[model samples]
Target: MKPTIIPFLTTRKLNPENQETPIHFLPQTITLKEYFFIRNHFEYPTQTQEAYFLPIVGEVIRPIIFKLEDIMRMPSKHLMLPLECSGNNRAFFHPKVYGEQWEDGAISQGLWKGVPLKDLLALIGLKRTALEVVFEAYDYGKRMDLEGDFHFARSLPIQKALHPDTLIAYELNGKPIPFKHGYPLRLIVPQWYAMASIKWVKRIVVIDHLFKGPFQEIDYNYYPYKDSDKGKTPVAQINVSSIIQQPQSYSILDNGKHVVEGIAWTGTGVIIEVEVSTDGGESWHKAILGQEQSHLYSWTFWKYDWKVSSKGEYLIMSRARDSFGNIQPFKAKWNRKGYGYNAVYTVKVKVE
Candidate 1:
């Protein structure tokens, strides 16, 4: 039985399996310890910068290797970005699929500092016709259901891999990353979900076409919109999502005023608004949006107040509309693989 960290486990490997578990927290002002749910394809190997070696390999003119000191000596770039699981909140829909059983705990934000992927590629002298670059890591070994070693790994398309925002992150939240969080070297594909940000990286290979390992071809890749044309629907990017965070449920009200607040974000743009419903979804009211953040990918906060009339059980829900005018779905579409579930967030409380 695989052990899990706290608040990170949505369901067990047993019947209650849910892989789309959401990471519940605002992207700004993060404490390293509280970053919601960590998904590692492999165990965190122990190796300091001096001991480990990072090599660029395959179809390249000059294969380069960097020691820890070499990487730290370079000019580092920092980016504060938010990432969400494509399958976040998928269990809310029908045909429950396999994944972390995430309730939107599949996200987090942090100050990521590292050399950009493109810069590193250029430093190594990438070939002109390199169609795609594959990141081969130290952690990939075997498959449990399969016979061989269960190695953990994933890959990205050359275009996405070389984006300026992509980072070979060495530090998270201004501190050296913790072991559970990819420690020595990891890829941070800003704005993409955590799955794409691999840990314990060791090798990078340049190939003529997209890499098709079990991860890129089988895992992480899911068919969206159930029973649809799997061919037509490529592995879609992170869909927009929002969640409420304030007014901890089950508090006393004694016929007084109250304030409600929450956070929201989109994979594509900033959150435009957060709507609140107090009458069990009978009606909706606009909540006062909180401090606007300049980081377009970071989550935004919102708030609303309830003038308590009577005390009883209250069912509350929050909906988010993104800058692109894509509103949160009341309930998300279901898939057997459980990908791209971005539904409205709901909560309940008892008032005195």
Candidate 2:
């Protein structure tokens, strides 16, 4: 087993590997490459930088192919982005959902270095008819839910594809992304769920209509109703959520003043505030939001100095509110696939 594989909580060990980060003790800033969470839908494909190339075809003025060395020589940009799997907290659903069954640790953040996708799109020049940009990955396999083998492909709106922040990342934390992650080239879609950031990208196709790949239409979509198909929407943005990292659930602590620390993040807006509740949602107190540790597309660090004078069992909870007036709900919207479970995070601890 690889050294990187030892630390994560393994969800799937076979054809397509999936691992969750140990978020309980993660660093306050960037999540190291070794400790980053891994979410894969298909088995690894053999790749060599020398033999790699990206072909931009469909709905373009002229089809072009970009070699690895040539693309690497172009001007690059760096960004710190947080990627949370659509199924990050699937295991927490009331009625167990059928999926990876991931816990809170399925999200991770990294400083990505790459070329902004808009630059490359400008080189090829998009046609006015282009509506969606489809990203094709190298990995392919048959899934139990699907009938035949299918490559893990997804599409983004033309506007989002041409966004200045979207990147075709080649490096993570100043080093080449590991094989477990997208090594040669990976799409880093900011603020969106990690599903939009397709890994192992080899082909880019722009179409005039919606691209109905299984990963997009069937898998990563949101089904609001219990059984009916009402209000089915695509899973895109990350929900407003916060995680408690310092004093873990069911931990025994000294009857004294303790610091409660955690992280909160959102997709479309900045995290304006985070409320920490020690009495199990009875009342909430504002935490000190770490502005220095925040970025446009990264999670924000929050801390609260909680004093415990009497010794007893205590329940702690944290919820976040975004700049767009989106607050964390008391209960998350239930879905069949269990995509975005962003309810208030609560933990029970014993004070001795």
- State how far residue 118 of model 1 sits from its true place (Å): 0.5
Instruction: Report the number of the highest-TM-score candidate.
Output: 2
lDDT of each: 0.68, 0.88
Instruction: Specify the highest-lDDT model's number.
Output: 2
Error of 1 at 18 (Å): 12
lDDT of 1 by residue, 152-219 (tens): 55666678878888888898888887666666887888666666787777777888876677766666
Name the lDDT value of residue 272 in candidate 1.
80
Question: lDDT tens digits, residues 1-352, model 2?
Answer: 6565334555544546888888988755898877788888877877766336899999999888988777799899899978999899899988878878798989999999889888898999999999999999988899777799998899999999999999999999889887778878899999899999988997999999999988888888889767887788999989989999989988999998999999999997789899999999999999999876446878999999999899899989999999889888888899988988999998899998
Give the runs in model 1 whose Cα sits over 4 Å from its true position. 1-28, 34-36, 46-51, 224-236, 247-255, 280-282, 311-313, 350-352
Q: List TM-scores for all candidates, in order.
A: 0.83, 0.95
Using alpha carbons, what is the TM-score of model 1?
0.83
